[model samples]
Target chain A: MTTAEITVLNKSGIHARPAALIVQIAGKFSSDIHFARDEDRINAKSILGVIALGASHNTTLTIEADGPDEKEAVAALVEIFQSKFSS
Target chain B: MKVYSLLSLGEKHKENFSFKVLVHGENRNLSHATMNRPGLALTGNFQIFSNNRIQLFGKGETAFLYQEQHNPGLLVNCKKLMQEPVPCWIFTHGLFPPKAIIDLADEMKCPVFSSNLSTSLFAIRSNQILTDEFAPRGVVHGVLVDIFGVGILLTGKSGIGKSETALELIQRGHRLVADDAIEIKSIKGGNILLGAGIRKEVAHFMEIRGLGIINIPHLFGTGAVRESKVIQLIVYLEEWTDTTTFDRLGIERHYKQLLDVTVPFRKIPVRIGRNIAIIVEVAAMNARLDNMGYNATRDLDDTMKRYMEKNK
Candidate 1:
């Protein structure tokens, strides 16, 4: 398992478009990735699951992935969060 | 629990205990899960009183408060009780607190509620709601379906056909409780595992591989869906392997624990030609039969033993 944390820096937070970007990035790897906010743990590959996190601006989210490419998957997700889903 | 949310649960059923909010607090939380009568505490005996609990003023307490209305101090005990951080005050039997008391409660920023149910009845119903609200809950990646009135949870790796099997069951007149991610709560003191969808807005909706999001109720009507159900059985759908071992007989029961509740469990191998829907249905029926004290495998073993003894 690999884990990393990132705060929602964008003023818009993880709305529909950002959630879609997360899901898209998460789908690139075979690892089982999930993002947890508070007590809620949502599958990152599912758009609805990402939206269900209900994360708003400044909410810190922990990304966890478990598989052969766990470390790479976690790094990929952190880069996306740090980029604020811009690219 | 949010006191506002608690109000919604208490007044959900009009017949059980119809509650009316006399004063709404600042969306405060109910600090405690239990209720208190405030019987002795009304007389200034503050000795073992739980100020965090919601105080219920029953007939006796109401009458006592009314009689104290004539006192020169103007019911100081009520004022004293309200001064504490009591989450709220509930008056039963359609009784209303004196205007003085209500004003005092309003000044203290304590919520006040009234219900038409008798004291004991309201207490019982609210306690039941509180117990459920405070129960432990968890979220599982699975699809819960009701077949033959049995709640069967299908769980496995993503894209392993849990949703596909559930769709087939729904086609066969079974009900879909939740799909993808099922939110489960254990109630009845951890004896019952109640399952529901993550949210009501997204319930009865499924995400298919190629079809995207589809509404079951819209596709199959309201009869094909249910809000929630007790998870009676769990089935894990996995890829088939030549060397994998499977349970041939239902003699030994397998259990899967959810929120501290044990539910009958089974693992079914998935293959191209195999019909997982029918297998799940049969599993549910078998569970129902087991509940009726009948075990086909055990019965067969006993019959075989009897025949061998007679021949010997």
Candidate 2:
């Protein structure tokens, strides 16, 4: 498994749109990816799981990925989080 | 997918539903849940005639047939309907079968039945009876209770306190559906599970070890008991043991199969000082939340990983 810590730079944090974007990106890879904050963790590929995090701006989150393309999955997720989930 | 022959249906529900057979069609089968009124079909418009459904001839249909008696095409249309393997024809409101239709039915060997009930009432009652008759059914050893608008079935061994927990739950304002033997029926092709007591006389009664056969509705009033409910969750009580490991995270979803239908299942260990009733209540509420797409375990997992990342 590959893991990376990334902060949410988006002003709205992980709201509906950004969560949907994360799910979209995470679904592209063959790896199982999850986002963890505090004592909670959820599937990165699930929009509901991402929205349930309620991670506000600047809150650091851990992205974990495991499977055939774990490294690529973690890298792509970290990029999405650092880029404020894109415009 | 079993079909009930018209003769068997006539024998089974004759007394209760007041079904009077006008003509006997021995080989005809009644399989569908829906009944149709072939008003347009009688007018020689066979475009939307549902041949598989049981046809009903009410006041309006009978009047139309009587008004159209002079039309030669009317008998032809009636014959066409009877020849298409239709289950049976019923005349409601104590209406007698018309001469032409009865003659065609007799010749075609199609079943014809009449009832004293009004058109709307007979339609509604027949629909319910047919749906129940055709539902996939099986008996489950459990206590079904309605908690927080969710139907939960409590299952366990013979002496594992299933009824006791149900009694406690009822005391907490939940409604008991069935005790000991639950009759589970899968309606709509196994998409739903409807539960009821095995017998109407013993429906709301429960048997606790020390307390023999307590009447729930009598003790707690009618609000504490329900005739039937759609089972949404199944909680199995097990004796706590060191050897058997349980699911601590609640991420793995479990399901139990009843009458070819699958329902959400949970295993709660019965141990000292553990309030099983409260756990069951919480489980019921949690099931509602899960259905609404809010899973606490998954949310907590996300939060924990973030904390770990910052500390590392």
Candidate 3:
């Protein structure tokens, strides 16, 4: 499993649009995508699971993916986070 | 959306979005303290000070006064200035701040500063610098489409047809907010989520299977889309794998992080003849229902519990 950490820069944190985007990207791979914040752990491809975490701006979150494309997924998602979801 | 209103305002002002502030520039002697504070003011204009080293921030219009120089008369005037007190200060580096301005800033109870570059360079560079520091520019691959008044974000593999599905949703009377990469911003209170696609020159338009790159705004008209929307739902598109288990019931909610907020989510598997667009739209409606306190999964669970009790 490849793990990555991101700092939330969105004013509302990790709300709907962004969570959905993450799930969408995670779904592209053959890997098992998981994200955790605080004490919550969830499938990164599941919108409901991600939203339940209630992550907000500047919140540090962790993501893990395990599979053939685990490395790629981790790298891309980390890049996305570093891009503040904009790029 | 509500989430977007919280983020610091973008420089290219949009009429739909507005901000106000009282701006007063002062030349002053550089102070070590006024190096890099940035935030908002009481009336709304973002404040910055350039003593030629660092930039500071004041978050909002109602923020407090921050300064660099230590001048007593100005300090007294600022303390007695009346009205609302401003918060935050941006100090420029390299440029020498005039003493009078420094005193005025101190008296006005405003934050002061220096810039790392010369005045003209600071003016040009400050915008970029501040934007880099304060703008919420997080982006993600998403298809933003409106369904029944709710903005839905569809995400998944490259071939999962997130864009195609969004196109269909638009044809079905839903509006498109963005395609491919969606830029999102979180506004104050961390609730409103605003999103928009990159400019047309950089939009990539979108080419789907069986269809070439189509100009969505051209075909659908401007009404078919919004410049941005609050992201409320996340629908993940996945290709079915024999080893993977999919959700049989629409109960379990999934989530992903962007900056800090958590949004409700659903996982929709992509398969032949699934009418992915319809499913996505339904998911959006269902999410809206959940927001309205009507949860299908919870209701079913309650019903099942009742049935067991009755049978027992």
- Please list all clashing residue pairs in model 1, or write none if there are none: none
Better of 2 and 3 by lDDT: 2
Name the weakest run of 10 consecutive residues (lDDT summed) in model 3 chain B.
B1-10
Ranking by DockQ: 1, 3, 2
Best by DockQ: 1
List, residue by residue over A1-87, the lDDT tens digit for candidate 2. Answer: 899999989787887788778878898997877777764456675444466567898999899898999999998888877777774
lDDT for each residue of candidate 2 in B1-312, tens digit (9 for 90 to 100):
667887887688876668888887657887787898898888788886799999989999887777556777888888877874699888888888668778778999888888989999898888877887888776666789999989999988656788889999999999999886677888865689999876666677776666555789889999999999999999999999999999998999999888778899999999989999999999999999999999999999889999999999
Angstrom error at residue B297, model 3? 3.1
Query: Candidate 3 residues B60-102, lDDT tens each?
Result: 2112333324434433433333223222244333333346545
- Which structure is stronger by TM-score: 1 or 2? 1
Instruction: Pick the winner on DockQ between candidates 1 and 2.
Output: 1
Candidate 1, B1-312: lDDT as tens digits: 434344455456545668788877544556566899898888778898898888999899888878764664546777778764677888998899878877777887777889998988888887777778788877787899999999999998777898889999999999999886678999977899999887766668887778877889999999999999999999999999999988888687799888889998899999999999999999899888999999999999999999999999
* Predicted structure with the largest TM-score when compared to the true one: 1
Rate residue B157 of model 2 by lDDT: 61
Q: Candidate 1 chain B — worst ten consecutive residues by lDDT sum? A: B1-10
If ranked by lDDT, best first, what sequence of candidates would result? 1, 2, 3
Off by over 4 Å in 3: A1-87, B1-135, B200-204
Q: State the displacement of the C-alpha of residue B100, model 1, in Å, after optimal TM-score superposition.
A: 2.8
Stretches off by above 4 angstroms in model 2 are A1-87, B1-87, B90-99, B102-129, B310-312
